[model samples]
Target: EAGVVQSPRYKIIEKKQPVAFWCNPISGHNTLYWYLQNLGQGPELLIRYENEEAVDDSQLPKDRFSAERLKGVDSTLKIQPAELGDSAVYLCASSLDAVASGYNEQFFGPGTRLTVL
Candidate 1:
């Protein structure tokens, strides 16, 4: 079966440009994750969702970055006025209900790499 799918695998934009990334998670997976991976660093959790509710988003940059999983299916992350420091890989991941599944095995998409010039 195919895993999570992300669009626009690569994007290049000048600084201060707005960018958005799309993700479609696996069927029946109710947990969604958004992560940011900087060069030479591990992925950092940007936000997390259970069904359509954002369960964890403390790490998300409220000023310029926002995300939504409207119907608990597809998700979108947007970064307005993107900065040079925002150049990184945005990853989408999904997993079955962590509480019910008893494990946190997440399937990750290829990710969208954004470059700010």
Candidate 2:
């Protein structure tokens, strides 16, 4: 089976522009996550989806960022009027289970590097 898949791999845009990222997780995985990683910092969870429901999104910025996991299969993350601070790597990860069982290993995509000038 294929691992998580992400598009564009890299993106460059000016501040105040809109950008979008896409991700497809592994088959049969019930849990999906979107994370943001600044340089030299660990990935911080932006949102987490259990199937089609967003179970955790406390860290997601609601004003300019939006995300959706449609039909429990695919996901998209969008940043409108992006800022220079938004320049970072956006990572998508998935696991077989949604429960916080501590044993589930998440499969991660290569990540989308966004540069804001």
Candidate 1: list runs displaced more than 4 Å: none
Find the 10 residues in a row with the least total lDDT in model 1.
Answer: 96-105
Expressed as tens digits, the lDDT of each residue in 24-110 for candidate 2 is: 999999899999999999999999999999999999999999999989989999999999999999999999886865668999999
lDDT of 1 by residue, 1-117 (tens): 889999989999999999999999999999999999999999999999999999999999999999999999999999999999999999999999966846979999999999999
Q: After best superposition, candidate 1 residue 109: deviation in angstroms? A: 0.3
RMSD of every candidate to native, in Å, equals: 0.8, 1.2
TM-score of 1: 0.97
Best by TM-score: 1
Pairs that clash in candidate 2? none
Cα displacement (angstroms), candidate 1, residue 89, comes to 0.5
Q: Candidate 2 local accuracy as lDDT?
A: 0.96
